[model samples]
Target: MSDRQKGLIDALQLVVPQVELRFCARHMHVNFKQKWSGKSFKDVMWKACRAYIKFVFDEAMKEIKDMDESAFNYLMAVDPSHWSRHAFREATKLDCLLNNMCESFNKIILQAKDIPILTTKYIRRLLMKRFLVKQESISQFEGRLVP
Candidate 1:
């Protein structure tokens, strides 16, 4: 959710009103650093984002306000639910701050599409070998779980 473009954000919100929208903490940190630079600020920002309790999040925010009122205000302007763990919906059960996994999967899919025939052949062989190995190892497992 780092797009930051008003139209894009609005469009996404409108399209998927039921989905919980969140900004990447890493991208927010980079943007924040560009405007204000300090290791302590970054640490406090991360602390606030990672806080799972309201009290802890408030404490971290208090520290930020004490250090820089403007910075605190800037953060306050952004919706807490979009970045803070304490404000996140527990129902979603998502603890991730970035979309790296989705991005990686998208890249893989795009690559496969660009090199369809070769990639299909390679992927088929890879999956066959992987499944065969897993199938062989499955019989040796002593527990109900694969591991």
Candidate 2:
């Protein structure tokens, strides 16, 4: 582990409820490689990721173990080096709420930074517009029907 991660773990050790250190899913998929691609493997990997999203990390691990014990054990043993589940779980609790916020902030900065600087009113209007659109889209996105 780097000095940064070690320091983070040390800080987390002091906090109650523990910390979840998650490896980003997109980051892992780009790094790990397989000898021969197979539909079953992809399905299993996605299933494991979806399980984590369900907010039941242990259940996800159990699913992975049932699918392939050896692979799951390998992943658990060297998790941060190979998987995102442990990292995500460690960073998910109350103390780490800024993770997602930081991502969203970064995205907004990246998109808006290049635009001409705006006054406070303009920024507020922009935010309100985005909020309304997002609120409108939520129901559609939440539904599971084909549209």
Candidate 3:
């Protein structure tokens, strides 16, 4: 997470003690690449992120340290629970690294998002129309499954 994001999380944690924060591996990789560039480094970084077992994660970290101690130390300074699958809370059942769905939804609502709060009626009607169109299309499906 960026310094601003970390600050926000820190503040939020004071208010909501139970809030669970997770970082996107894609963003972490991009940040890491900005400092260290190499296909081998990228592969090892991803390997560490994707490791589902502590032993596997440790082994990958060993390889990273062997290749570049600084890179390994950088990763060690960050919380593993935020980036590595091995330390994720089982209750969340979150299996993905990136928030692609949220990003896609933001893109889909880009036009609607620009409407001023004073003119909510126009946005509301637009959203209603969109919802109706989606409902009609969904109703056309003959199978039991919606997808």
Candidate 4:
């Protein structure tokens, strides 16, 4: 494996030790689509990717317990930084794995990149409007859903 791939594996082992090393299925699907163009395949791939992310944590823990006895034993000694689904909790020391926080910032930049130079001002205004709308949507949704 390349240094970059090895580093990712190492990081995963350190952060989420009880999970099997699984590549992000979203990224794998994008790569597969780039290699072979097929809309039908893309749709199915996306469905599988969603399912994988939704359920993989439990499956991974099981696999880790079964496949690597020594590693599993070591991991059991390390406490996971428990993250509650709807509560604000600080990440434990092991939670340094660069995750969606970086991706969300990159996504914002990518979304703004296509703005025409002449229309940059207009694009910024539009972006602000869209952001406010999204903020309000979230506030409303959370207000309804959260206590």
For model 1, residues 122-145, the per-residue Cα lDDT tens digits are: 667766887899888887789877
lDDT of 4 by residue, 8-106 (tens): 767877997865333443444455566444765555443333332435444444444564454345433432222211111233223222235546645
Per-candidate alpha-carbon RMSD to the true structure: 4.6, 8.9, 3.6, 11.6
Query: Judged by TM-score relative to the true structure, which candidate is superior, 1 or 2?
Result: 1
Deviation in Å, model 2, residue 20 alpha carbon: 2.4
The residue-by-residue lDDT of candidate 2 on 1-147, one tens digit each, is: 112234665566577334444444443433332521356545555555544344455666676678677656655664542243334444344322124565675576565565676544565777899899987887567456745
TM-score of 1: 0.73
Check candidate 4 and list the clashing pairs. Answer: none
- Per-model TM against the reference: 0.73, 0.36, 0.74, 0.32
Model 4, position 81, has a per-residue lDDT of 23
Instruction: Name model 4 segments beyond 4 Å from true.
Output: 1-6, 14-16, 19-22, 52-100, 105-147
Q: How would you encode candidate 3's per-residue C-alpha lDDT over 1-147 as one tens digit per residue?
A: 222254777887799778667777888888899988899999998988899999999999999999989999999998888888998888978767776775775676677667778446765776799899999999899988877
**What overall lDDT goes with each candidate model?**
0.84, 0.51, 0.81, 0.46
Q: Where's the lowest-lDDT run of ten residues in candidate 1?
A: 102-111
For TM-score, candidate 2 versus 3, the one ahead is: 3
